[model samples]
Target: MTTTQKYAATGAWNEPEGATPRGTVALLPGRGETAASYARLGRRLAADGYRVRYVPVTLDDIADARAAVEELLADESLPAPRVLLGSDSGAALAGQFVAELPVDGAVLAAIALPGSAHGEVGADWADEVDARTACPVHRAVLATDEEFARGAIASPLPWETIAIGAQDRPTLALHGTDDRVTPLAPALEVYARAARTDVRLVQGGRHDVLNDVAHRSVAATIVLFLESLRLSPEAPPIVTGLG
Candidate 1:
């Protein structure tokens, strides 16, 4: 069964049913994305016997993203051992929220690293930087990605701080080896600072890894990681080889 509801305080949310309610996995979409973007993934999780909640975050609602997450968790009516799955800007927001919440784990895809959007560069330099940067650069280079244009990049908060602060929580950082949007090098640096070992770099994968063929494997890995935590929240981190 699937149910769609409006989270007056957050935005729209889609809830999918499952047997025994394995647990709720809050799906946070990227910049300029709507809850519908996660429909496929949410439905997949729901079919896999896990309750899935897709949350939409827009530019105007970015500031309330964290609060919205808190509100979702406060419901108490949901199942236990909830996890957060976020991409792009949503990944950063998830990290910040987890630091204040009691989630069982998190899966971050196409995570933006600190300084990835900082510094001023000319169109030519931006183009050059995009070619050399680890994450996807087309968006940043073209200055069309709303996340960067809407002042999201200029925010003073550091990604390192958020990652490090959530050190104790089980986290899975998924990144595309050739992601030009969110450089992989800076993301790895932040992952290292957090001493996190559950990082996966998918080869030939782009920023929209969630929609790629590798999504199945990625989702399976995430489910396994969540299950491992369910059994032992303090289990040792399982790091997969970089693709």
Candidate 2:
């Protein structure tokens, strides 16, 4: 029987229906967002046959989110071979979380670049920009956004710290080539520094590439990355249905 649990930190989590629990994938949301934001992605994963959970971490709920993940893993009702899907700020946190836990793999999307706060390429600029502009100039303009600045302050995890710990884990970074907020160049640098050989850079996409036209490609890449782990058959199926 499939089970659904509501955690104090995370909002709601759903497992596979009428099947033996295989594994768990914790989906973390971006800054200023709730776990509910991942509902569409979760539904797609569920349709593909994997038990999925959306872990919400509000501005002041990082501790709660971490505790909830630990507790969920400890619960006998959950499955084994856990994987993490973290987007934006959540990706950084997920990296930190796994440093202490037994995680199988991780999918990091739209990750902030190292030293981005002080660098030219800061997080901002959701809109398109001229490709001719230098990366440093473009990044500085992107970082000037008030919303992005606020999210940076609110985020509990730092990209540099996460990148350091991600060295040992088999990580897959899904970044948008035209991502103004989290530019692809800096993100790629961080991924490279992590020594992760497997990284996917999607072109003509923005920070929210998961919902963009590149979603199908993103989903496919995610499946392939997870398969490489060879941990278990518990990971959710790739979302082939492109809405």
Using TM-score as the measure, the top candidate is 1
**Least accurate stretch of 10 residues (summed lDDT) in model 2?**
1-10
Q: Rate the local accuracy (lDDT) of all candidates.
A: 0.61, 0.59
Tens-digit lDDT track of model 2 for 93-173: 776676666777778887644454322323433323232122443244334433333334223343344453566667777
User: What is the Cα-based lDDT of residue 66 in candidate 2?
Assistant: 84
Residue pairs clashing, model 1 = 135-179, 135-180, 135-181, 135-182, 135-183, 136-179, 136-180, 136-181, 136-182, 137-180
- Which sections of candidate 1 miss by over 4 Å? 1-18, 58-63, 114-164, 235-243
lDDT per residue for candidate 1 within 9-71, as digits (tens), equals 233333333346667787786654555445556656666556667666543554677777777
TM-score of each: 0.71, 0.68
